[model samples]
Target: MIKIFTTIFLLIIGSTGFAIADTDYQLHAELIAKNTYVFIGKKEDFSMVNGGNILNTAFIVTNEGVVLIDSGPSYQYALQAKAAINEITDKPVIKIFITHSHPDHFLGNQVFPDASIYALPTTIRELKTNAESFLDNVYRLADYWMAGTEVSINSILPLNSTSELIGEHSLRYLFLKGHTAADLAILDETTGVLFTGDLVFHNRAATTPHANIEAWLLSLDKLEQIRFNLLVPGHGEVTGNISPIKQTREYLTWLDVTIKRSVMDGLSMNEVINLPVPEQFQNLAVLKSEFMRSVIHRYPIYEKTLFEQIE
Candidate 1:
């Protein structure tokens, strides 16, 4: 613990003794487990302050090369992430996995274009269909940080039907639509580490522009059945325990119930936004902002469903 803290302290305080090349760099990697490292992004919302580096990316060093979980939010951020990985090992990144169709998760493909990029076929379809509008919106939200970032994933090979073996490691890919149309969770059978894309977000309010709440909830149950030694989320800290899964489940359940009740009560969007969150979720970063966005995206569906049921 002390060693990890010391390294972070030096990087943060810009200690001249440390080997960090740029003192102003935004992301940092934490050694989470044997042969595994995670670059946890900011828990805050998209902003110039964070440069939209608010999505977690990780890499595992293997005998053949490195396997990157997700590129960061943009081209520049991915470059920074790769540089950080390079500081430790010169092994080239052999593979890239897009956990979902969200812009933040896949736009960084431009930075790591050398590797074979893979995503669920459904994810590829969504990106192909919505990439234009999504990129436009992401450019506005992330602004300067995404200045040069364009959708570079021309063809994301379908990651289906089997595990890809690299060296002695077997990467078991699971298709989950909990967080988006397609959320990919990779389990490193060698290390028992599960890279759970955005299917699980800890210590932060989850964004749900493309989420099916019911499907996402069932996905959490699937997570409970999986065996993993360490869990790395698309945002927040890595954990050795399943507490993060519990956190995600509770938050989603509360959000679903609250939104459904608000719809039944005929609450306006603003009223739903103002509704108090459970105390357990009050401290999460960007809680209100994300919750408001989620309401805007999902509440109308509930309203329509209730209207049809009444009819």
Candidate 2:
């Protein structure tokens, strides 16, 4: 009996150690301007591993208080973000704008108690119905150690077809259905900066798992009509002018054409996976293998001719 108990104890200890070994956290903070800053949480590159660090969280701050763009994946991340923001400014976070309902974008919302939270109506519904599964998946599939912990999500500010003015900026909420039914972009007219959330990726591949490829392509074109001096993407670095937006449009166009052709030709998903990106898109940061997988996962719905698409 003593031997059996001793073995179980050793196994438990070993299991605990393994869990700790699998978790890693790193946060990056950059000041975009005198009054605005962007904080990002980085995890280990998991493209090589089956399920490793795969998501990043971004925060945007202003003088009145802080307007959190997307919460990180876990409570620890939320805490880290709060601490980082405190270092930048002493004001309480006034509002949190969830770009969508994705767990990575909103799970860390638990950290802020004094803020009014805003999200699309669809996002609020999705969170109510799917937050449980979302939390479970993060715990099971995420590479970070804090995935096993529970994250609290509270207060849903749902916007159907309206814009909110915060401070000197008017946050025009645009409903984009492609990436997720409730994906939103925060357009700041004061600085001509568009907080694109996940609508565009600066240097990395855009995640399209829950995206509508056709609508996403069209959304890109619509964004081009709007003028913005800077774009704060959900992932990768911030971009200037309209070049990155144009590049995203081009890539989506190529993806729609290439993948649709492969699908019609009876090519298996694996074959489509091996398709090479166009030479023009080779220079974009998100076209690499890791981001390519994210794109391929949502390849089926994105059907359109390259010529019909614009850059």
Candidate 3:
């Protein structure tokens, strides 16, 4: 099975200009708060080396059972996460929350068959629409690690609810958008920890393939108002302050302004792609590549809007 998938992966990625490398799959859960742990992934893009483990997945242990934040990129990753969770506690995972439809965040849904996997209703709609394409892409990028991985969801979490008590933790669900059409931010009211999903990327460039910058900035504002002791971003390291929220806001704000300015300046896509990144964002992981991607994803829309204004 592994060999078959690998051969197919090589063929698909080769055609799509992807290259493979190597990286270990070992995962360790870092305890961020009392009874709360997070498995931080690399602050890099998906590669065979990282095997698509480029997003943070977390868990909280409560008296009833364990609550998992996101599954992960592949079955292997979920297995590693489960093993890591077991090392710390023997509690069974009773609930799983998928923050968004991003493949790296939810591909491992099959691994937790018993856990009640919940995604926002819109998130479920997105997974239903895009899971197959996402699966194909991950297989092409991660190959053997993606074996047996398939899109799976057991429940749709309504966006209307404000909070729910599971185990000893009171989880407040924030249904907001900007990162995608449906993004779920989970706040552990009991632990004062906020899992901001992909809405906030710390020390890493935010991806905008499905981004609505205006909406995203609004979501950031909402997150800023929420008081939390620690923030676990979908990517990057955990922080005790709202620095991540501020950083994401700054980046998105800059991206929106820059893109609009460039379009109005009549700059071509290539020019925008090669433009120098601001000094502040220079140190972000995958800064250049993600910026380039954002340009490619958003430039045309900006161009179209400007054209419409003149028309």
Candidate 4:
């Protein structure tokens, strides 16, 4: 009877892949620099297998306490992240900074109720206005992995650059945009680690759900001017070089030109999705899917702008 029950359980899990996504998030922290660790996420889109763990979340172990960069995807992810942090140090997380208003970056805010959560005024406003819908969308994609997760933001980060001396680290915040209406990039003056939110995607294709290509290019230019020893992007691995910024710029430039050309050529959205991808961007993770998404999200705006110009 026990053997039969075990077989039945295996069958259930095999038949439905989501049955295996039990509560364990399996988070591990990777130390990148002196007292700085990053929880690198999978380079894939949201699915039942990855459970929305497709973005980076990092924490800085300072003299005072832990300073968290982004909260991650869900309540379970935050719990597991906190547990992983505990394995390294017992200090409480004093501050949680949400880089942008993306669901993958800030949904884990609920688990850190004691910590003060901060984001740009635009981020806070975006969360307040669209968080529920974003939650609904993730819940659909990740299923049970999003259990008990809710939208939470406590404080608003200033819309301009600011500085804070926390413990042994001197932090400088850069307010920039292009990936979204507002993106926050943090430069740790003490360690030279720059955390550029989703403003830069290393080997992964950038999502244009809220992208402003023109503004995004300008933000990248600003980032290239900053001298940083290490860069922790919102997605992909941490790097010490400026290649990621260049890669992101190249892709966004291509995307802008492609979409504008498609509109001028009177190509349908489906046609644009089927357009040939350049060899350089072919190696990017989720290239085709992200390109399709970008077309669906941004093509209509280009179409409308071209129409207005013709009028």
Error of 1 at 9 (Å): 35
The residue pairs in collision within model 4 are none
Error of 4 at 176 (Å): 0.5
What's the best-to-worst order under TM-score? Answer: 4, 3, 1, 2
lDDT of 4 by residue, 80-146 (tens): 9999999999999998888998899998888887887788888888888888899889877876677
Q: How well is each residue in 1-311 modelled by candidate 3, as lDDT tens digits?
A: 66466656765776677854233478988889999999899999987778888999999999999999999998778988988888888999888888999999888778788888888888888888998898889888877667667777545454567799987889999989999998999999999999999999999999999988889999999999999999999999999999999999999999989989999999999999998888999999999999999999899999999999999
* lDDT at position 275, candidate 2: 73
TM-score per candidate, chains pooled: 0.89, 0.79, 0.92, 0.92
Better of 1 and 3 by TM-score: 3
Candidate 2 segments whose C-alpha is farther than 4 A from its true place: 1-24, 41-63, 147-151, 283-311
Model 3: weakest 10-residue lDDT segment is 15-24
Report the candidate with higher TM-score, 1 versus 4. 4
Candidates in order have lDDT scores of: 0.83, 0.66, 0.88, 0.89
Tens-digit lDDT track of model 1 for 1-311: 44335435646555566443232336777888777899888898876567677888888998999988887677778888888999989999988888988877887788876798988898889989997787778666755566567788785788876587888788888878878878889899999999999999989988888888789988888888899999998888888888888998899889889999999998898999998888899988889889999899889999999999999
Worst window of 10 by summed lDDT in candidate 2: 43-52
> Model 2 misses residue 206 by how many Å?
1.8
Pairs of residues at least 3 apart in sequence or in different chains that clash in candidate 2:
178-212, 204-286, 205-286
Summed backbone clashes in each candidate are: 0, 3, 0, 0
